[model samples]
Target: MGTNTILDMRGYRRPEPGTQPAYLFPPYKSTLRRAPTKPLVLLPHTLSEVTGPVFGHDAISPGDDDLTHANGGEAIGPRIIVSGRVLEEDGRPVPNALVEVWQANAGGRYRHRNCQPHSPLDPNFNGYGRVMTNSEGRYRFQSIKPGPYPWGNHSNAWRPSHIHFSLFGPAFVSRLVTQMYFEGDPLLPFDPIYNSIPDENARKLLISSFDWETTVPDHANGYHFDIVLRGRNETPMENKR
Candidate 1:
């Protein structure tokens, strides 16, 4: 066998219909410019993609899970504790997975220069955190509730409060990116990105439920948002290029 020889492992399964958003959704204006015009060519998975190095505790710092006090001071906003598990399609726990999250500040402003100028930024909030799933595939983190901001996609178009989540299962090929919306967000109905998923039930999976059990006394509210890698009940990931 050669050093570049690919593994003959079982290939990944295809996602069910309507579970994922189409690459070209007109409502999401940005997709118009990025969506592929030609048919997508599926490529075979290589050994590097399936058996790549994974990030572990060594890559994570002590305070990486707590975004509230990541900086010198505490961030201003309603603090929230988000906890959940990463599961495989068969409902098996995916342990030691790298879960990263990033979001806008409480005022709907990001630290990036391209962020909306109207909303003020929170100096104490960098709005980024990461953690590895435990033996039970559970992970937890703290952050400020992000505020909605206008994106000018359509007339009076505003996005719902959402946090971006990225997870690496066991290898680079298992990486997935998705967004978690807060339950009962009125903006959900108007957000094209959230509505892009054809399956109503799958869309609901992206919304995190309020978890009173994880809430701290007078400190932070808790929310639970589990992720399903693949299956009929898989969570809707972002469209691939």
Candidate 2:
């Protein structure tokens, strides 16, 4: 019988400890330069109405037949009316705010690059639409339920059913890019886009609630997603205006 003994080698280094490395590393300093602080400048501008003629060659035609054909087609799934009010943080109506939305077709296919092949693309589904808010800062769109599509990552890889929203506020200072998702989607936790917003409250703001009341005459399902844009708060002195 033979027994093997192991030796304890605790501290062993090839070169040496505390060896200074030679490199040109800049001194660490705060990159933020202090500016001459002044009172915040507030600009005044009227909200633009989303109705009537607007410049932008890409605006979709608001033809009733377009909506009808989109709803009646087999590839076009459930018809829904997405309506909401665009308001300021103070709850004031943001008239004339441009709200553009793009989403996957009812079959859960998008008009983008690197899409899956198994999912059938809707021939009628342009997968794009836009709307402008009314006088009361309200906007509406006729669309269908977007199907959840699988990504190449895993068998369960699916994005939460969502619609991309782009808002151009009254002033150039008021622009925002965001997306709306359906509430209670199982894929929310796994979807990268849905998880992009770190703030829970901010994330919740993007999910629309199913509103049966907002359904159109023949439509059974509808969703309401109100968006709030940043704006100047009215001061007490401004009440005189």
Best by TM-score: 1
lDDT per residue as tens, model 1, 67-149: 88845798999999999999988888989988889999998888898886978888899989989999999999999999998
Whole-model Cα lDDT of every candidate shown, in order? 0.85, 0.65
lDDT of 2 by residue, 1-241 (tens): 2222111111111112222111221121111243324664443332332112443523545642123254445446887778889997668898777777788887788877778675887777766677778789998887777878877544567877888888877555457678889989888887765654556676788899998878767654779999987655344233123
State candidate 2's TM-score. 0.67
Clash pairs, model 1 backbone: none
Error of 1 at 227 (Å): 0.8
RMSD of each candidate relative to the true structure: 4.7, 21.7
- Candidate 2 backbone collisions, by pair: 48-96, 49-96, 50-96
TM-score of each: 0.90, 0.67
